[model samples]
Target chain A: MEIASFLIVFFMVRYIRTSLQTAVRFPEWERILVIVQYAASGLLAADVFLDSSITKWLWHLLLLGMVGAAYLLKDFRPVRNVWLAVGPYILVSLFKDIAKLIDSDFYESISTVVEIAEIFTLVWLIATWVSTQRQQKALEKERLKRLQEEEQSRIIAGQNVMLEQLVAERTAELTRQKEELEQTLTELKATQDQLIQREKMASLGELTAGIAHEIQNPLNFVNNFSEVSVELIEELKEERRREDRDIELEEELLTDLTQNLQKITHHGKRADSIVKGMLQHSRTSTPQREPTDLNNLADEYLRLAYHGLRASDKSFNATLIMDFDEHLGKVSVVPQDMGRVLLNLFTNAFYATEQKRKTGLAGYQPTVQVSTKRLSDEQIEIRVRDNGCGIPKTVLTKIYQPFFTTKPTGQGTGLGLSLSYDIVTKGHGGELTVETEEGEFTEFIIQLPT
Target chain B: MKVLVVDDETDVQILFEQRFRREIRAGELIFAFAHSGEKALAYLNEHPSEYVLILSDINMPGMSGLELLRLIKTTYPAPPPVVMMITAYGDSESHDQAMQLGADAFLTKPLDFNNLKEKLKSAL
Candidate 1:
């Protein structure tokens, strides 16, 4: 019984410590039961050495009180287990006492039955407590697993949002770079066109100069021979007058000869003018200002440029619209330079309209219009407008810059417009401006102060 | 008086003959012709004393008229034929160059025959 008491005390103390460590509330009734059980155990231990029946009886009474206290605290897990374990033992003790009092022969069998019942109850209590503890542990493990999965999913969701943001930012950057690349490509194309135009103009100028030089010798021969023929005819006429034979026939022959000579003079002068024009076109000359008729100058250059284009491309044709202000009268300008300016503008106008015609667009009629208006007594305005493939807005600002041309290689010397601009603005103290809409029409306006 | 006309164009011979027909028939003036500057130089070498005047075209395929004038002024015998340089290019630069190279007269073409006749008579 002493050893049993020690073992029970040890188990009870360990259980209380475990409950306290686990932060489980210790009930008031349970505390009292524990103190009573300790006192009972002490009493029982003293009786074992002293051999005192009173001490034993006191221990039995304390044990009965402990059982009653356990019953009152039965809602607590540890107390319920203790009450189940101790109740059977206490009942058995009471039964033993009754049997002794009755003086029955069944006392020993009853005690054996009581002992079996106690052992069974103790086993059941231990099993119930252990099962409850294992169930609680499993629930805690499940909750922790669920919390961890939630935390991992939250992290993954944050990463997904960051990845999407990065993708959007990269896409925006790519679009910006593509725009920049396109802008650069356009500029490069314009520069390449300018360079090709410059090369073509340089070669054409050289070729035209050579042709002018070669033509001069023959032109001189024609003019000189015609003049000498007239003189020889005059000498022959003088001799015939002195001889006085076949006078009527001689006069008829002389009249025929003089008419033929006049024809030769007229054609020779025309050839001279053409050769001079070619030479002037090939060479850059100092500006010489004189009173020039704006109407005649515009008319002359418009026809000249049209003929020049026709000489190059036989299939090209356009209806020229000329609206000259006859009242504009004479303006003080360098006629040669102004003529060049008009020629360039007219040529560009014709070229634009011709290009539009080549696209095979039905009902497209190429037309270039040249108009002059006297804005005031001091200012004259000249406009060359075309219903053609207009200048694109992107390239409009660069047209006056040297070497900027829309024409293909070998067709233009981008210097035409640039030189014209220089002649009008810098050389003549005038203004040159342009108006255009892409794919619709283009107009160049020159305003000169008379 | 004998005059030498040096030119590449063969038609120039006809023009001169027609213009001065009376003078040639009256034995007042004689004319000779050479096709190029080199040929003119060869002619001068052969008949150094026969010619009184040299009218040479400035531009020629070989041995330009200017170079021929330089040779005639420096290497020819004393009293070399009066050298005249003519060109279709009437630019001041050619005129200046011809005068600098000892040409007696620099003429531009479509030659004014009346003025040329006066100049030729005055020189004679």
Candidate 2:
């Protein structure tokens, strides 16, 4: 429809050339080309109406070529010259047609001009319609292709987002699985530790029972011998009191009596004490819990523990500083269990400092400091500190874990600290914490609720 | 009073028997012995509460002393004999569990005879 309107306007300007040019003021060459295109169209119309195959075909071809040339030509002057050349050819044809009959020629001329104009209008309309259809088809195809491309890209981008989300979900699931596995491993480790502790107890119980049994015999002999010596001493006393004593005999008997009594008592008491201590050590008695004074308990173990270490290593001259808070009150605890915990701490401190000395770490003298304080009305805090090669930060977490140890295998069952931790935390509902700096010092702090 | 000493180790039985030899002669103490929980149960079934005290080790191969104590406390409620649970480990859990199971006292290995004597004298 738009093309037909444009063609109609173009024909209007061509037919009323002089007046339209005067109104629109177009360039002279442009007006001349418009006039020649109109004339060629008119000639093709006349030929079509007259049924002149050669002229109509040739004229149609010529019109198309002229339109193509208009677009192709670089300069308007060449087109203007060609139209000016064709103007003279038309006049010559008009003049050469004088031999024709006047009456028939007049009708032919009128009819031919009218028919040509009608034919030109109709043919131009068909051409305009066909070109417009082709353009519309091309535009529609382009629009469909653009829409298809857009939809394809949308699907691809959606798939990419889905893939990324799936990957994230899978990663989160894997992380959750890993966490569960870690928790299970930790629980299994705890169970293993308990079993190991039970095993240690069994062995120690058996060993202690055997030792106590063996030592009881010697203790009985000492006690019996001591009783005989006391009886002999009484006999000597009775003789001395009843008779006038011979000086040499009396002196010798007195000396024998005193010396033998001393020997008997010395061996007797020594054996008795050893048997007693061994008996205490061998008994697999269950813990008896009571409200216990933590400070006093700490002081007691501080002496025994230090002395025990000293007995084992006479060269261990580490100074043990006891800083006990006398005002600290009682904690609900199993005294024996608490004693063992304290023993473990002091021994560990002593051994750690001793190790430092053995390694000649920084050439510093070893020291184990035990301190206790009343943290609050409800809590008591005890710290066992040693100037030793501190555990590495990496190993600190596992220090209280059973079977994790840096000491030589013989030196550690790896259950000392672990058992102590369990005793403090699980047994007494307390807390045990360690603070350490590698190559400097380590401190085990215990907090018990009063 | 007759006392049953249950332990896996022969040395334990010997020590117990020896320690109470004078009392046994005076008719003040009597002794029955079992090396394991099964044997101890068999003896108890035949002679119920003939012994007043049950002393057993906690870490036995089968039917630990705690288990035996539990059984005796639950099944033999009438004149249920006093039970002293003995363990070398001395963890809180065993102590608490034993007490909850109606044990008279809990004793750790390396037993102080005086302490045991006091506990037994009180319980018996």
Candidate 3:
């Protein structure tokens, strides 16, 4: 039992030291308590050899002091309970010592009861110490979990920063691409406008030759008729001043003067219309579409083209047949561009007939016919047909190709049909098609969607 | 004496009739008009030797005044009518070409009618 008590005191020393390390602040005092417990254990071992009453008394008193020292460590409930387990044992031993001195018989019975009580208190102290250890372990696990959670949050913060940077870079690149695309579209539109302008200027060059020639006649008539009218006025004045005024001759002179003035007025109007036509032909084209009367447009251009050809080549004559749909109301088109297309087609038709005329085909009257028709509610078609030297089958397919011309050098730019094709097909979303026979006739048709 | 005026402008006929009214009315000068070189040639075909002098415009639709001059001077029968080339072009090029084509005179428009009358009188 004493050995068992010594082993329990040894375990108590270790358990109290660990448990008290957390609860107690005084290290030197805890050291002293540990020494005291060790001394108590030694004394319990000494009791097996020592037979003297004084020695027995000394061992028990030292054991009693060790338990009393543990009471100072009240932070541990088990240490506090150690006093309960050992108290009566110490008292019973002290009484037994006194009984030995006085020679009494009651000591054995009382010691047994105190010893059992001491064992019960020891069991309760050990249970409390074990439970305290489990509590400390749970606290250690909670601290470790908190450390791992902080590390994960730190890593997440770093990833979020990188993700935001990536998004910013991608957004900047997309913005750059959008800006580049807008710039390219602007450049492309500018280039398209330039090409159309160039083609317009080229056709204007063709019209200039005829204009110079045609303008001469009206101007000549205006001058000559007015000059002759001035002479008639001088004659009428002479007749009025005569002694016997010739009324019949004076009236005839006045009538001739009136006729000459009318001719002057007629020629002046002709000049005005020619200048207006030239202005319209040379007008810069706007890219936007607007409402336009197709019949009026065709008629105006056909006259210009014919007069132009007449002025340049006096022998070039054609029977112009216009079959315009009177009910063909205003259609949406880029007026300048569409006008250019019509002029190009008219100039070509006239050229074709003139070529056949030059061949001196007997009884061949050069004829060019332009007709417009409304095919449906959504579509309109214009056909320019010529009974002249038609497109040879070999060169027919290549007519729309840029820089291709069957006409003599310095006469055709070869851009006319190609540009006209582009204006009809791409600009207006229409189709340009040609029907031809080698030496019979050629007809160009323009189909448009309303 | 009869003079034929060959030009593409029909107005030339009216102008000549009015401008030379005194001479025409007196029958001292007779004027005939043809609107084109082709018509002038046709007129000549009908009356080959009646016309004493011809006044022609250089630029006409069929058979230019220069070509007509060439035909009249070379192809037509003897006693050709006097051919004067009147044109809007005063350029030395057409003048030289007309002269080469045997044009009796080259005149520029707007015609100096007074100068034309003097030249016409001299040619006749």
Best by TM-score: 3
What are the fnat scores of the candidates, in the order listed?
0.28, 0.00, 0.40
TM-score-wise, the better of 1 and 3 is: 3
**Residue A380 accuracy (lDDT) in model 1:** 93
Model 3 earns a TM-score of 0.57
Candidate 2's error at B120, in angstroms? 42
Ten-residue stretch with the least lDDT total in model 1 chain A: A203-212
The Cα error of candidate 1 at residue B89, in Å, is 4.0
DockQ, each predicted model: 0.11, 0.01, 0.24
TM-score of chain B of each: 0.97, 0.92, 0.95
Model 3: residues >4 Å from true position, as ranges? A1-182, A285-339, A349-414, A418-433, A439-441, A445-450
Question: Residue A47 deviation, candidate 2, in Å?
Answer: 12
Compute the TM-score of each model's chain A versus the native chain A and list the values. 0.43, 0.45, 0.48
| Alpha carbon lDDT at B14, candidate 1 | 63
Candidate 2 chain A worst ten-residue window by lDDT: A85-94
lDDT comparing candidate 2 with the true structure: 0.65
Off by over 4 Å in 2: A1-139, A146-289, A299-327, A334-340, A359-371, A386-405, A413-443, B1-124
CA deviation > 4 Å runs, candidate 1: A1-177, A180-216, A244-450, B90-93
Candidate 1 residue pairs in clash (backbone atoms < 3 Å): none
Best by lDDT: 3
